[model samples]
Target: MDPRCIPEKFFDIKETEVLVTRITGGNVRNALQDIHVADALFDLDELAIIHHTDCGTLTWTEEIIRSKVKSFAGKEHWAEIDKTVYGAVADLDEGVRGDVKWVRAHPLITEKLKKGTQGFVFDIESGKVRKIDV
Candidate 1:
């Protein structure tokens, strides 16, 4: 759902609560690289790693992006970007499960597993959210 489409009253979030999203492949790297998100998860009651079908990030391979980066920013920057894959996945259901596993394995995230984690795939065509088992 476009979260903003619903009024805040529909959910419990308020005051110290927050609703956050990582739109890029729904990668857990955001929490790994960003300390604030890592810290905040401790307070989270649950973490839902959401992804959808036909996401654009799955359009290109890391090698392709690396080659383009080299073409645009010269060899140095491309080398810096190196082997970093942006976690793109062509299979939507597997992708969601993979993200759930990724979050589960992250060091800080593992510490907060008691807070619950799940995967979901939002079907754009059906306007439905289907849960995925990780």
Candidate 2:
């Protein structure tokens, strides 16, 4: 997570007021397990999938990231590594929409949660977050 991309400050919210499941590219695919757990436990009011401008994931392809990791983690773990989603992003708007759509369609996320799900793009330059209608 980027130090400058703090949702609390960006949203003008208190630290304990929100439950954030932050991940690279803000991909809901990577946060499904956490979403499921939270859905089952908490009465979450909203699910905001926030992707930002100039994310590192935008700089490289998934294959390129995997190749670099393979060089360091060794081929022995390639199976697991290959299975992982590196979350390489292209367009910020498209990324947010895809994640929101994916999460809303996921069977594990409750219907209530899905209905409440929303997408956003955090403009790193402007320090602002805008909602994306899917």
Residue-level lDDT tens digits of model 1 in 12-85: 45855646654476665555544346556555657766666566656877777777767778666665778667
Clashing pairs in 2: none
The digit string of per-residue lDDT tens for model 2 on 68-98 reads: 8899996789999998778888888999899
Off by over 4 Å in 1: 1-18, 33-38
Say which candidate scores most in TM-score.
2
TM-scores for every predicted model: 0.74, 0.91
Clashing pairs in 1: none
Which 10 successive residues of model 2 have the least lDDT summed?
Answer: 36-45
